[model samples]
Target chain A: MNPVRTTLVWAVLVVAIAVPIAAAAVSPLLAWRSPAYIAAGFAGIIAMALLLVQPLLIGGYLPGLPAPRGRRIHRVIGAVLVIAVAIHVAGLWITSPPDVIDALLFASPTPFSDWGVIAMWAVTGAAVLAAFRRRFRMRVRTWRHAHTSLAAIVVVCSVVHALLIEGTMETLSKVALCTLVVLAAIKVGVDLRVWAVRR
Target chain B: MSVDLFTRRTLLVAGGAIAATWGGGLHVPAQAQGLAPTPSMRGGSNNYIPNAPIVERIGGGGFWMTGTVRRAGDGAPLAGQRIQIWAHTTEGYESDPHSHGATLTDENGEFRLEMPQIVPAFGQPHGHLAYDSDGFETVFLRPVMPSSKDTSLRADFVLRPV
Candidate 1:
């Protein structure tokens, strides 16, 4: 990459990650909240930000990273995403068990809760599929198709889920981050022709 | 190898377009629009025992919130557990005068708190409570809203051992 282009890429990446965080930091709600709640809310936001990075990594669009290295980092970040979701849900459960139970049972009156639960389960399904990929002994094309389809579900549902929730996350920044995540995933999915891969 | 139809330049342009469209349509914060606050926004998981002195009170009036903190599975009462309570009232957030209070569980793991008479605002007249103890997992209760004409509320907590 040219030096100017490389610098621009880094700058864009930094801004994409930093903007949402800065917005959340300045949230009016943060001033009156407990530390545990703050940590939980930020964990969810950080998880959303990581969604953007995951697609970039898969596409090898991040500067200085080789394709293989990016894939490895992608897997590592996938695990981090799982942990982040765990913290987010666990925090919510501790704060309100009935609500979490309602969400899990698909009975929560809040539309955002339903979307969040669906996205959480979809992400977990993708992770489990990835872990068991070898044992399945599937053809390469079949595996890619399945994986990419799950990725699509993870991306779309997570974005919708985050956007629907009007909580700790600042509105404009959250929407911006979510849009970027969807765009990145779509770009990578398109570039890779994940849907068309065949044995 | 899979065929790539989107070149780097095209992908970048698409991303930029998405960013521009999204950035141009920003709106005010969601809370201002009457959306319910998530547990984290209200305050994170209530896991740690508050260090302040615990007030023990027994009263019933406009609304009295009472509960027992017990161990999950075993159903043992967690005595001496610290519980923090707060709520948004018609007056203001919990930080405003007479909107927040804390107490400790008695030997039987029972706690009682007196809530301010709050007219519904933002959402409903509700009380927020958090239970914390040395060895039990932290438990946070949602803002409890009065269901009927009852002036007393019971919001029990069952915490797992960590």
Candidate 2:
């Protein structure tokens, strides 16, 4: 990609991630939330935004970084994404353990909790495999298929989770970010053919 | 008979205002100040708790939950119907026990409760109201504020009695 196009892509990605974070920070609802709850909420928001960048990093959608460097950053980001999810869950746990427990057990009445819990598990599975693939002597092709499927689950379920939620991000902005995340995930999935591992 | 007829036919135009807010996001406009019926939206009541104690106010100051309780069809002010109000307020989260309270309508069918300002939860500044008093169909009204700065949220209910 030319320098101009690369800059434009990077700029768009930045906006895709940044605007929602900014919008949530100023949400009126934050006024009454506990610090732990607020932290947890933002952690979830960051995790969702980071989802937009992960595939782009691995698939070389963002131009300036070299392939090897981008992969390294992708690994680092994967770790951060996991941590953000942890904080998000922990914060909610502190604020309301019963609710979190219900969510994990899949007995919560709200539909969003079910989706969020599923996404969280998908993220956990992908991270665990990525972390131990070398020790397990996992085939690169096998790992690719598992990781891709889990990533798809994370993106799709998390979008549903966030959309089902009514807080933090503005409606239009949340919709915009979610739409972009799905589009980027699709672009990379189709372009890179990560979904299949016939080779 | 005519009074009952009016009450039955009376559509809480409040839904139109709610629709406007729904179309634009929960930014309650000038019209949501009137009482409203949930119509078919009890989904947002996922956080509802059973039998919250009636109290004088939810929080300290600024925000107000005010509306009228009218009989469906005739729009008669139904005094004595217990109206439960709760929200994520400066004092507590909507789910917190302390944040919930119930109030009764005056003879005029008007209800009012003062509390700390409502903050956004899940990103929208909103309040929850319900008519849990028996003898009438239960209603849960989740009304959003026009802006974070708005101190008052009104959701009048024209309840249909069973």
Candidate 3:
């Protein structure tokens, strides 16, 4: 990549990741919150930020990195995303088991709970399918199609879940980051053109 | 390359187009009324103690609250009742500083607590109090906002028998 172009790409990446994080750091809600809750909330926000990176990596949009290299980083980041989510839920569970149970059982009165649970299941399903892909002997075309479809579901549901919750996250920055995540994923999905591939 | 494969230029263009449309309307519904703030409930990992150590008083700085625990049906004072209180203050929330404490009621089913003056992040200055005793259903009183004009506050709780 040329020097000017590389600088521009890096600037975009930094701004995209940093803006939301900076906003979260300055949230008024952190003033009187416990350490554990703060940790859990920030972990969730980091996971959401990671979602943006995954698509950019998959689409080969990061300057100076080959698509194959980006894919490798994508897999590593995916594992981190799972861990972050676990921390988020576990923290909540520790605080209130009854509430967590309600959310998992789909009996929670909170609408955000339903969306979060759906997105969580989608993410887990995608991870499991990727893990067992070789064992199932699935064709490349079929696997890609399923993977892309699940990715879309994950992005949409996760964004909606984040947007619905009026919690620690600052509203404007959260919405902006979620919108970027959706746009990035859709852009990559369109680029892959999975639907047009012949079996 | 496969017939369905897209060129790099196509991906870039698509990404730009999607970005351009993001500023438009995208609505997320508001949370239903009566939903509790999730942060206020974080009592740490070992929140459940079989026996909470008894303390004479729980906070400091001229802010005191005295209350009595009684049975809902007959208004009988219930002694030895364990009460747990947590709140967020200017310093931080419970577990951050000295924002949480526990105490047992005296012989007359009355308890006195000393707490730092609180100013909550979102709502009015408040505290969370819970009562648990044998043969009685657990009771939780949340967002117990204090009146600034009064140095000493009177807040009582009535528990229902199981």
Candidate 4:
């Protein structure tokens, strides 16, 4: 499929997934028990897992991709992950508005809220720094350093948020997401260590 | 609800006079002085701690609200209020590249919400509520979205007339 077309398709799919979740706002009964939410949450976790690795996946750190193909794949995965996270966040919001607010504002008075809020801020900062890297005349090394740091923060916080929350994930999905978070973090750490040693 | 036409006329005339004077940069508008701080919503990340648990207070207003919502009657809990909230962050607007949104309420009338926690102290995050046949419009109660958390804080809105 054409990349642009594929992007459009995924965007719509995300909205389609988000609407019901938002509409379910009127009734919790319409939420929590729905399979759509479960599917979306797990799917989002998987896509986000890919998103976390996108820099390396695109930078040819992975074995299979030629430089150009790696770059293209990374971009595709990043876009897909954005859509996935949206569905994930939206679904959670529909289930519990107050709790969602708690997470976003770090006001839930729950420890998980702190982690979630921190992850959100880190993700935002990373995106901004990456976008303006060229304009700011940042050294490629510095940009890479900043990007990697922020990405790590995002992954760590998101994993914590997902793990602590009792809703949606349940036993199996929770285990799967946690596993992905750990594996991704470990791989990133190993890659960083190797890069440092080579330097 | 008696309308005092004489007072109303004088007030209207004063308001027009003030507008005309302000247009020419003459006198400062009287309306500007006594304006109370209206509650505003914000989204993004912040750290807000309220000073009082009895009075509904949100600390630091930007993209998020970190205050407590409580009941006015006997301080009992108000469990099910459908709240729809959205806001922007540094990365995008609510429901956009830099935003987050949610719909939820407390199970026992006391809920804690965290949306995008922005820190502008005056702007309220845009929010909607479903009163659930309680004769309250979605807009009846003042909604605030603070960007940080307040430990043991409560912001109460009285639904019935005092």
lDDT of 2 by residue, B1-162 (tens): 245533523555666666776887654443344435446243336457878787887757678889988876555678888888887778987678888888888899999988888876543567888777689888877776878788899997888778
Residue-wise lDDT of candidate 2 within A72-117, one digit each (tens)? 9989999999999999999988876655776789875467888999
Question: Fraction of the real A/B interface contacts present in each candidate?
Answer: 0.00, 0.39, 0.11, 0.00
Provide TM-scores for the models. Answer: 0.59, 0.66, 0.60, 0.42
- Which candidate leads in TM-score? 2
lDDT of 4: 0.48
Model 2 ranges off by over 4 Å: A196-199, B1-54, B60-86, B94-162
lDDT of 4 by residue, A124-172 (tens): 6776776576798987777777877887788877777756654333335
Residue A145 lDDT (model 1):
80
The TM-score of the first chain in every model comes to 0.95, 0.95, 0.95, 0.64
Per-residue lDDT for B1-162 in model 4, tens only?
Answer: 987876977999999998887775742343333322223223222222111122121223233332323343344344554433333332323333213233234665554544333321112222322222343322222244332232222233323212
* Cα error, candidate 2, residue B136 (Å): 16
So what's the TM-score on candidate 1?
Answer: 0.59
B81: Cα error in model 1, Å: 33
Candidate 2 docking classification: incorrect
Model 1 segments more than 4 A misplaced? A197-199, B1-162
| Comparing 2 and 3 on lDDT, the stronger one | 2
Q: Evaluate every candidate with DockQ and list the scores.
A: 0.03, 0.21, 0.08, 0.02
Write model 1 residue lDDT over B33-114, tens digit each, in one string. Answer: 4332122223323222354345443222356778887666556677878787755433344444345568878899898876
- lDDT per residue, candidate 1, A1-99, as tens digits? 888988998899889889999988987656545566577788888889898999899899988986799999999999999999999888766555655
RMSD of each: 19.3, 10.5, 17.1, 20.6
